[model samples]
Target chain A: MDICDLGIVDYEDALCFQTDLWRKRVEKKVPDTLIMVEHEPVVTLGRVADESSMIDRELFEKKGISVVSTGRGGNITYHAPGQLVLYPIVDLAEKKRDITFYIDFLEKTAARALNRFGVPAGRDEKRRGVWAGGRKIAFIGIAVKRWVTFHGVAVNINNDTTPFSGMHPCGESDIRVTSAKEVLGRELDMSEVKRVFAERFVEDFGREYSSQFVVRSS
Target chain B: MGKMELRLPEISAGGEDVVITLWHAGEGDYVASGEDLVEVSTDKATFDIPAPCYGVLERMIKKPGEKAKTGEVIAEICTDDI
Candidate 1:
């Protein structure tokens, strides 16, 4: 497995890259991969996302935040620079061919990674993401095709959560959103978070992550 | 010719049930081996089940949105080769 770091890219560009990698992975052209990327502020809708979940749409437009609908299964979520999005393009046929287990693995992987940063994040039994201090700190929405996985979990490291107030996070309007910086009361280095997450995934999931491409935001 | 059962695959461990979200091949549809035959969703994720062998989808024991246990037969396919 390879972990490719593509820093601070547009959300659509990252999705396009994920799609290409997903195809390659399904076709057995490349090894399983985990892509870590930070997106330019945007709000995305998952497969089951509802437009009514956005409480204030005009506010997002004025702030230049784009709304996009995706094929991943889940609800609405926000992304921005400072957040670490891990898209794991893996062939499940090569591992445990269970969708439920894969989803749980993703949540557990993020929670374990956050633990390394001294943030005690865990999953809410009724929810689908990682939470800390009674607020969600990570979100997961993934899709699988031909037993291969794509679209993955995102952890809020030091990203802005103010925009999240305008929309329901994963269709739960009452949900409070937080970040690693918010919990620790300090700004966190995005690259460090990415590195910790990559290492934690390898440790927790027992997969070899090859470091091939590393890009940093200028 | 005999009918081969298309069992609800071992979707997960611990014997959890999954909901059949959709059936790509209806009864009487000729499906090729390795082609996607149905879609099933667990609590958080959705995945497709491919045809086990080239045959005519003779019967559907489970429909969309129906709950099925892992390893339970969900459909049957009539094949001369088998």
Candidate 2:
């Protein structure tokens, strides 16, 4: 896997980038890539995001956050500067070929990275986000095309969590969205966080697991 | 000529509700090999199941909004090749 560092980009432009890469990946033109970015404050709604998942548009509008509908899985979620968004353009057909495993892989990667920060991060299967001290800290939302994957996890390393209050995150009504900064009570350097996360991801995404290993592990 | 069976492959981990979201190829429509035949949602995301071979879509066993299982024949295609 390769890393593409795109500092603070608009969500739509980033999506276009993913689409282009995804097409190339399907065409065997590029290898798997991980794109790390910080997005301008925006709310993205996925396949399961319904009217019930989003209640107050005014909350976003008052804060100048744009809401977008996406093809990725999961529900309404918020993103902004200081949040580390990792979009892994991967080909699962070349690996395990399981959606659930891929999602778990992402959650584990984030959780282990958070552990480095002493955040006590863990996974909640029901809500599908990594939690720390009972507060949701890292979010996972992904999309796969022709067995190639895109649209990935967003970890709250130092981002503002105020916009998350505007919607029911991941369609869960009673959930608290916390950040690494809130959990640690100290601001972190964005570049360092990205570096740690990328390293953890590359490590956890152990290469060439046997087909039996994938079925058994997953 | 052969009738190709189009089944929903194992897209999710296991036991996650997989639903046929939509059909990209209509019945009687000519579909190329590897063309996306349908869109299905599993684990809350959507992915396409491609046609295995160039053929005319002879039947659609699964429709949009219907739950599907892996290896379940979702469609049948009659190939043009001799």
Candidate 3:
């Protein structure tokens, strides 16, 4: 597993990069990878997002937030510079070969990482994504091609959550969005958060990405 | 040449039941090996199942919007070149 931390990437550039990585992994050219990045403020719509889930077009334009249609499974979601996004390009054929299991793994990994930071995060069966209290602290929307997964979890670290107010998040307008900073009452080091997240992810799926195969970006 | 069975693969964990969402290859259509032939949703998300071998689609045991189980042959392909 190669962990690449692309600091402050544009949303469209990240999508193109993920697509290329997905194709490379599908062809067995590269080992399984986890691409981590924080996007410049933007809103992305998944395969099922409809007009009702989004806010007015002029509002988004005025705020300078770009709206993009993503290939992942879920509804509309927000992203910003302080959010930690992890796109794991994992080949499920060699692992569990099950989408449900893979998604469950991601949810577990994120929850465990949050637990280490003294934030109580868990999964809600009715609503996907990890939550702290009744407010959502993290979101997940993935797309798998040929059993290789991409477009993963987004964890709010210290970002301004005001932009999320512009639309219905994850198809629920009343859904509350929380962050690690809000829960901890202090801003955190993004790199340290990424470190803990990477460690927990390895702990969750270490069997597949063993010590000998794991790679980290400097 | 024999007929190749295109079964509803076990794409999700837990249950094998799924809903046939789409069929890209209809009966009598020539499909190449590894081409997407059908799609099914397992109460979560839709997944496209690819053809196992190059052949003409001979039959569709399961139609779109119908319920199916894992390992059930949804479609059959005559492996003989058409």
Candidate 4:
């Protein structure tokens, strides 16, 4: 998989970039790519998200964080400048063609990436994200078009988790959100996290997709 | 001319719940092969099911917000050209 790092982009900018790339991928004009981005502080709501999921709107407004409704599946999520968001644009038709398995793969892949940094993380069966010591560490929400995928996973690396409290993160009101920094008691290097995550993502995909699936790590 | 049934493909072996979230085409609308017909979402992923062949959409069996099952017909397309 090719890797493109658009560092500290606005949410709308990344969305447009991902949309264009997604269409290209669907048309088979481009190879499968992994897009890494750290979005400016923003709260995003999925297509099926209901208004009731939002709470504390003033917190975001006071912080000047923009709220945007997006097309990914899930309820609500917050993204910030330090969050490590990985948007893997893959063609699943040539892959396993299973969205559930794909999502699960994303969660597990994120868990492994976090583990590489000494953060013990794994997927929660009841909730659909990576959890570490009962605190949600990563969020997985994706959108697919014509068997091609976009809008991948987001892991709380060195980001602010305060805005997440404003909305029910992934629609779970009682969920406790944590970051790699909080877990390890030190701020993580963003570039290092990206490198590890890119490596782990490539490794897991290559293992699952067999020899024909060629993916080079960043 | 024949009518083709667009079935919801298997999203997972884990019995993950699927719901039809959006329909891009309506009854009497022409859709090309590979054109998105509807959007279905599982727990954490949303997928757009494309039209299998060029045709006019006859009707939708699964509307937005309705549960979808693997292999169940979600919409019908008439294969006749206008």
- Compute fnat per model: 0.48, 0.62, 0.22, 0.78
Tell me the spans in candidate 4 whose CA falls farther than 4 Å from its real position. Answer: A211-218
TM-score of chain B of each: 0.92, 0.88, 0.90, 0.91
Mind giving the per-residue lDDT tens digits that candidate 4 earns over A86-149? 9999998888777887887899899999999899999877789999989998998899887788
User: Compared with the true structure, what per-residue lDDT tens digits does model 1 show for residues B1-80?
Assistant: 78899997776666677777778888999999989898776555666789999999998999876889988999999996
Worst 10 residues of 4 chain A by lDDT: A209-218
**DockQ ranking, best first:** 4, 2, 1, 3
Superposed model 3: Cα runs more than 4 Å off: A207-218, B1-5, B16-30, B38-46, B56-80
In the range A1-218, model 2's lDDT, one tens digit per residue, is: 79999999999999999999999999999998999999999999887678888889999888788899998877889999999999999888877788887888888889999999888999877768899989998888788878998899999988888878778888988899899999999998888888999998887776424544766788
Local accuracy of candidate 1 as per-residue lDDT tens digits, A107-208 = 888998899889989987877899999999999888787878888898899888999999998888789999999999999777788888888886766642
Per-prediction TM-score: 0.81, 0.90, 0.83, 0.94
Docking class of 3: acceptable
**Model 4 - which docking category?**
medium
lDDT digits (tens) for residues B1-82 of candidate 4 = 6999998887676766699998998899999998788999876778888899998999999889899788888899999754
Query: Could you tell me which 10 consecutive residues in candidate 3 chain B have the lowest summed lDDT?
Result: B39-48
Superposed on all Cα atoms, model 4 deviates from the true structure by an RMSD in Å of 3.5
The candidates, ranked best first by TM-score, are: 4, 2, 3, 1
Any runs in candidate 1 off by more than 4 Å, and if so which? Answer: A62-64, A207-218, B1-5, B22-30, B55-67, B72-82
Supply the DockQ value of model 2: 0.57
Clashes of each: 0, 0, 0, 1
lDDT values of the candidates?
Answer: 0.84, 0.85, 0.83, 0.88
Candidate 1, clashing residue pairs? none
